[model samples]
Target: MGCIASKPPIDFSADVNFEHFKLLRSVGRGAFGKVCIVLKRDTKKLYAMKYMNKEKCLQKRAIRNVFNERKILESLQHQFIVNLWFAFQDEEDLFFVVDLMLGGDLRYHAQRSGAFSEDRIRLYTAELMMALVYIHDRNIIHRDIKPDNILMDENGHVHLADFNVAASIRKGSLLYARAGTKPYMAPEILNKSGYNQSADWWSLGVCMYELLRGKHPFRGGTTEEMLEMIQSAPIKYPTTWSEPCISFLSGLLERDVTKRMTITSENVQEVLKHPFLASLDYDKLINKELVPSFVPDKDKVNCDAMYELEEMMLEDNPLHKKKQRLQKTTMSKQEQAKRETIGAELQRIAEKFTVYDRSKVKSTPDVALDTNIDDDEITSASPRPQRASGLAVFSNEHDSSHMSEDENALRGDSDSRRVRSQSTDPDPLELPTRLVTPVVDDGSSTSSPIQA
Candidate 1:
């Protein structure tokens, strides 16, 4: 009997790996990897695929750092933060599929919206405080808390991103690694003194100041100057800011870790104690019940399209061209031997790399829900909007080496370094920390991420 043929049943038990995702377009780049918009082939779910070339990672001695990031992310799950979904590796690249942030980063919005209103900033701070509480409770310290790390959902609620520089401190021992972006680094980290969770609040203060005022509270001409200023200089606040804000910033931006050491231990509300977030509902914030005042327009892809240009335009390998090149090339014996050596190294590394699938865990519900955008809504390419500026990349990391290499080595991302120095009059994205104007457009171009 000529019966209708049936399709084969799906094999959901298979491991989730690099082959499961279809690269959509390059969205951004890190020191050792490129972040691309990708879709899961089976479920058609969208995500940001952070892939690092095995050879480059090994050459740059960043293979361990990439693996550390994956491990740290796998153990963490929270709302108000970019959560990792799947981590896997291939012969060519190590891949991390994470939540896709389409609303752009805070720096992008600050360039457009200027200083967030006091009410808005209040909410933003409160939300992040909750996130920080969760992280600190777990003994993890997020060293880099700059505007670039604060991403927005389509709903405009801020979520903390980037854990490449995060370090876990033992119960009693303090973190001595000199990590974090210089502009937002806590003084304790800068001076090489041991620091704990307090350092994160200090960076939060820096962000608060930038959001409340358009400029950073500290500014300098060079790295040494910046370090000196951040260390020795007293932070000044504009009179326009409310007394509550002044108090908040003073507590957060305190140079003496002793001052903020206890108050900011587990949460931001301890010192203020219902004063700052007196009206807030902690439960609602955690569940994302309260809506943000500002919602990013969904029509626009809110990031500079440079990453896409680099991936598609510059012919950076790893698209269909990579397959084509490999297919066409006829390797000589020497080249084949070299390739075999690399393959062996990759195999050794791959054994240690664990594979994760989020769907396997049904006990944990969605902490932060996925985007509402349907599969068809993404189209062929996640087209970026024009004037989607938030282009900044850090140059170097301060390698104190006080702690283990795995703790501090992940801070430097060397994709490329382009420093744009402004004459100090605009949104204080990655600017000096000396009493900034509200983060708004003053008819001048914005500042780029600091390169220290």
Candidate 2:
């Protein structure tokens, strides 16, 4: 009898790597990296691909935040939050494929579009509260909830994005990291008192107020002056605003945690029944049956065109360039030696990151909620050590127990310790002052020639 013939194993390797997608356009950028709209070759599905350079991450001391962000997102799936679909790493960068919000961020809309109607703001509030209820149930807090972090879809539905600074709090525990932007931060966070999930409620109230007023509730010339406003300033609602609107805002912005309205599993109905959202249909809202008042123009790519221009003109290594060089980057002998040392250091601190695919997992990922890295502002008061060469590496000997408080309380670990100093009021005088693509080859440019 003739020997039976068998097919060799199908190579599924390319499905998860950089080669799997075609770069469509550059959308937006964050402190860590830039996001691109990419089309998956095999599935023909579009996604927002966020790529962060490993070198830049280490240099910025953001690897921990990146790692924690990935772990937190892996376990989360929400309608009102950006959902992660795939995560993988190349030789040079870490990549995340997430739901694409083509309508752009709220910051973009707030600037170009005229003042938002109160009815529309009410709809948005109901949607976001549902999201808050979901995340808080799982013990996670979205520390950043400003207009910049809120994104809109083609149909004008908003989803919260950017988790680099998000924290996971254990039950009954408090978050101490100084991790939010100015003005949007709650009084407790500004005060340096250990804050619970109520902090998120405060931020939401600020957003509700800002969307209607076209300005932040707390304002000053500098962050210092603004922080003072956050601590002691009364939330003054305009006389033109409705009485219910003021009541909803006051409930959320209440300085007392006990009185501050929070959304949780136990209180979901209570939040939905708020006077601001009394008539909202919870089922219709979650099902997206309620028509949004402001729908983005489907014909336009809602992101800033400047991002695409920047990718084409100024990127050191553009996406198309990376596409051509599919082989692993060849490291010099000296660089290889450095990587060897860095590799061991990373292994000791954290496990190797894996390429995660949702289709393969039968259940939620086993990623731990704990970030392991010290987020206590006191521990990080001294900025991560930097080197003149721009290749700063985290020391393998970092000991959390040996940090000494700086004598400068305003800018040092002292800001982090005020919560425990038995002070009821926030320090009034305190304020801490703190990727690319594309190209058009102009004859004036000295950049490497772009190959089609």
Worst 10 residues of 1 by lDDT: 385-394
Q: Write the per-residue lDDT of candidate 1 for residues 89-116, one digit (tens) a residue.
A: 7656777889988777777667656777
Q: Candidate 2's error at 63, in angstroms?
A: 0.3
Clashes of each: 22, 4
**lDDT by candidate, in order shown:** 0.63, 0.67
- Model 2: lDDT of residue 116: 72
lDDT of 2 by residue, 363-408 (tens): 7643336644543321222365322212111231221111112221
- Top candidate when judged by TM-score against the true structure: 2
